[model samples]
Target chain A: MENLAIQLENVSKSFKYFQLKNVDLTLPTGQIMGFVGANGAGKSTTIRILMGLMQADSGVVKVLGHSQPENQTLVKKEVGFSSEEMKLYGAKNLAWHIDFIKSIYPQWNQAYANELLKRFDLNLEQKIKQFSKGQQIKAQLLLVLARKPKLLVLDEPTTGLDPVARHEVMAELALILRDEDRTVLFSSHNTADVEKISDQITFIDRGRILDSNDKESFFENWKKIQVELPSETLLFRHHRSIGIEQAGKLASVTTNAFTPEILTDMQKQNIKVLAVEKMSLEEIFIANVSYRRQGE
Target chain B: MNLRLNPSMIYKLTTKDFLLFRPFLVVYILICALAAGVMIAPIEGAYYLGVILVITVSIGSGIHFALTSVIIEKKENQMSFIMGLPINATDYAVSKTVGGMVVYFLNWLPMLVITLSLIYFSHLPNGLIPISILCFLQILTGVVVVLCIGVGTGSEGFTIVMVVIFNILFNLFLSVVGQLPGISEFIQGNEAVFNATFFSVFGIEILALILVLSLTLFIKSRNACFL
Candidate 1:
């Protein structure tokens, strides 16, 4: 319990149009958990609940070993949160923000902040309003990173960045996780970044978490099988398949519940397996969301 | 768990707002100074000009601070930034209310003192001094209401409507208080008089101020969503 940076149990919240139901999550220290969800899929809502910016209608949220919102002040002293909805004071310069945050957090590191300034190429003297979107995002990240927090929760941190800027941000995140005691839980629909860095990943759609697992096991569990049909009348029939993209005689089947039996089942159908490929994080997320929506 | 208030955090938050509203504070102070000069001047009808200027400074600064520092924080999405800090909504509400009132009075007190001094030194009835003090309380009450509304609603349009109503109602209050028997008697007579009616008016203003602050805190503490 002490090793976990964040823990959510049976947490629920409902709005007029959406609801997050019984979201149970646990991210231990020294790991990054990527929260993937579509637009308005309750990703930000869940993050807000954890930060104590919003209260859950039911259940518990614990961050940094303290009950959230109840101990939010204590929790916040150790957790650094950044989200797209959170804006920097436009009238103030980076220097002012640094000073302001430094005054609040005792763990602030001037040396690391300076290093980030050089790395991100952010001018501390320039007002935040003068920064470009990517620069602003980088500046926000720099401020949070320099705090040397025990836990970092970022919501869509790379949503609007160009590819280069995205790379820079991802690289900086990787650098932060070098400290074995630090943990991060970031939400993004951009699975590429999530795939590259997250040790654990959670998929949310509408208002529920569809799946949560370690990156390697999560990837290993999803398989994309391409099979060639004998006559095109029927491709391959398997109970485990969640999605199928067919093009003429070649049928691609995606499955979340992959096993050795799938190959035997395809062989029994006289279907020639063309290739068995691993699904990317994005592919798995799409297939997973598609499967859940279909079930609903 | 016991709820604890961090005084240092509150002070820092208050100081942050003070710095943020520094430019507006400077403008209000200058206006106040000009109003003070007008009150002491010997020009014809200078008293009326001074009163009008004082009212303008009082209400205008209230509206300006409530809009710029209070409402604009929500409009610009800076509430999330502030709430993202190591403070809760309670702390934020307390800071805004305290900081705004402090800055408001920084300009208001001096103007009140100077204007009352001018009245005292001049041929105006001593009773007008108490009336003037009551009027200042009315202005404080209005400003407090505006701040409370701004913090509680976090809506510019709603707070603006309330401020408009406060200004109109303040004028009505002044008219009604002016016509009170005790006040009218003091104005007609040249002596300073402590009257029940005048104290009742003062009590209402104090009560309103307290109620607004308490309501702001109540609304803020129950807020489930900051952004």
Candidate 2:
């Protein structure tokens, strides 16, 4: 297949209050990778490292085949980034920002920017401070997307946006990804967005990556199973792989390695299966965090 | 991918920045005009009008330029947006310094011409031209230093503290030395103060430019994640 567009190997960083440990992430050249994490989960930190905005205290980070913080100039030319904390000049209008970005990026697509302007329903002449929060987010996206970079790193692009605005932004991102030549890595607490557009998913918690895999495999691997156990008997008492919650004789078990063979093994132990349910991304995310916490 | 700096883009941003300061510009002009009018009055207070105007312009330009430099980026959260562009951080910092210098010069020109004309006619401060030039250079140095501190630390309180400390130290030095046993005579013996002031101002200007350049390099080498 294609070479990875972004790669991180055992990258780590530390602050007085927080630590990011051994974050390993890989995004193939033509796929959308959704970064799923709760607040304070180090998702932004990881993205920042990849963008060469922050250096890793240890390990290696490569974006588009160039080492970061050293070759950032080369990588910046091909990477488009937007973050919630970032803003345009308050005195500048959308048109001014557009022209400014156009001047710096030789690959700027005027037609696309014009289209985004119309699509976002933004007046080119109105100063940024006058725009609503959703409009501001749209304006930010327009500025980044118009540059037509090969890789787009967006941090919470839809945060604080209304449902309709979120949909519009998601739709636009999806449309951009259809080209099969561009890659996107977007971080969000909203799992639905990730579930809808991501080909690969990485879930991070407590400054460490919990899981990273294809979306389909992630879903296929995690499952919630209900089992009916005999009174005073525990089917998962000795099972290390199963996360068991027992209420009376009914036990709910969540497993990351779910399979028919595992279920059959449970049945052999005289545990009656009540239900086998597939876990959603949200459920998996919560279970992943809870599971980590339980281990701690 | 396209990677080129666009002057049109810089111009657009510069225009926007200028527009934001339009009201302040008007206020500054009014103050200059009022001070000039007051200086032309035949009164005892008119003696220091030229000096007052010079001081006003210096302080006004320094504070206004510094405030603009600090607040513009923070207000808009444009740091990331600018960093995301193809241009390096060094270029970005240089552009800002150049932009601030342009605006400062534009604001200072009117006051300078008016003050000089009035001084020429009134025969006050016989070396008004040279003194005014020296004052202008000092203020320019102040602008550069303040802007650099603002960008590097990204804190208004810190910049204010630095400015206050600088002013206090300079004034204290002047006061103590001007009263020294033979220092004052030595300083006046060969117009050393004037020559020293001119050279020091020039030295500061060059140093400011160098500091700005180094800051740009520091920004580029810094991890983007911290920013």
Candidate 3:
């Protein structure tokens, strides 16, 4: 955590009905971390703490080497935050908002802003209320991106956007993220979006971090091994096997520690390997959650 | 004050509220001008009407400013965008209170001068001066209440109810102060006398204002994320 862009150690926050307990996270500099969580999975709450907008009941939160809610102003100068709940002044035009932001941020990139306006197909003179939801989202991104912040903490930024709109926003992020020094913590329930852009991914559910690993490892380790079982009497539990479900002549095995030896071992046991299929992030997330839920 | 509190950002937020209420300020000027013209007019009963107008305008303006700047901002969920900026919670509270109270003062001071000047030069007893000043002080206290409720709690219904209740209490307070024996004896006196009762009441108002402001800042620090 010493040289990381973000770190949260044993962070705990409790509300009336929900509690985030003993959360520890670390995202090194120059990495895009996709924070994946289901609805009400403490995604926004954790991001709020990182942005210095919320205080943890007990924990250490450091962003850009400054403690949160204490060094918020100092750290916020270099952090760009955008949430789905955030909104611009509706009575004002986009140009007015641009000017207002430009006045505040000394490093405001007007040329980049102008480029974003054209790319997002947004008009400057029109009032914010006149824009559609997609346009408003693009406008928010433009404001956050144009400042060229060191860290971007986005909470469900593409939540309600259409497929095309989501693509446009994701593409914009992809283009700007070429800078090796810039880091992004993008949270979403949509695994496809996360899988497309994230170098590292973290899974959160019920206020707990279930898993965190690199994108390649997630795809590499999780697999759906379809098998042809000789009989139903066999107890199929491999050393690395997560869960096995059999339907008479065939059994499907889910594994997190998939390897070539596991297949060879299955063949020695007289089980025929029909196919070894790689798991999508979404499938792996569902399988992981279901498997975890079974333990409870 | 925390070192993280940014003065420039506070200024930007305060000025943004001012710009948003530009129409309100413009109407305030026009209303005061109309009231002034009426106060000095030769028409009978116009001065009374003008006094009522000034009081109404000041109170209404303060309530409107609080509703829009504090209550509506939260109801519309604009506080999220604001908290995204480079500002501490305490500083955000300061900006709001300063922004609302400064406008309230701008509206209050002029009416104070106009009403007191009317009493001083007119046939109304000079004894009314201290009472009038105390009434304006109470209005200032009422504004602080609105700020505490609207900014601190972010409750619109509660703030509106408080404003209405304060209006009734204002009249009761004025009548009660006017009936105090030590001050009532000089009710028709030619010169305004500064009594111990006046100072006692003034001291209480100042104490109340300070306590309310402190309470607001405390709530803001805890309620930053809630907002």
lDDT of 1 by residue, A96-206 (tens): 889988998888999989988998889999999999888888898888989988889999998878898888888877776654556899899899989877989999999
Model 1, span B1-227: residue lDDT tens: 22255677888877777777777777787787788578667888986888889888877877787787688888787777777788777777777886678867776787788777767777666778878889888988888788888988777888989988998998898899889988877874666677898899899899989888877777776654454
The 10 consecutive residues of candidate 2 chain B with the worst lDDT sum are B184-193
Most DockQ-accurate candidate: 1
Candidate 2 per-residue lDDT over residues B119-209, each given as its tens digit? 5566354344545554555566666667767766767788888688656654554455445443344432322234564455557656866
lDDT of 2 by residue, A1-296 (tens): 57989999999999999999999999998889999999999998998888877778999999999998667767888998999888877766888777767766899999988888887789999999899888888898888888888898989888888898788878876776674576889899999989988999999999999999999998888888888885656554435354788888898888888778877887888788899888899989998988887787
Interface Cα RMSD in Å, per prediction: 1.9, 3.3, 2.1
TM-score of 2: 0.85
Question: What DockQ, on C-alphas, does every prediction get?
Answer: 0.61, 0.48, 0.54
Better of 2 and 3 by lDDT: 3
> Ranking under TM-score, best-scoring first?
1, 3, 2
Model 3's TM-score against the true structure: 0.89
- Pairs of residues at least 3 apart in sequence or in different chains that clash in candidate 1: none
Top-TM-score candidate index: 1
* Candidates 2 and 3 compared by TM-score, better number: 3
A190-225 in candidate 3: lDDT tens per residue? 999899889999999889888999999998999999
TM-score of each: 0.92, 0.85, 0.89
**Better by DockQ, candidate 3 or 1:** 1
Model 3 chain A weakest 10-residue run by lDDT: A173-182
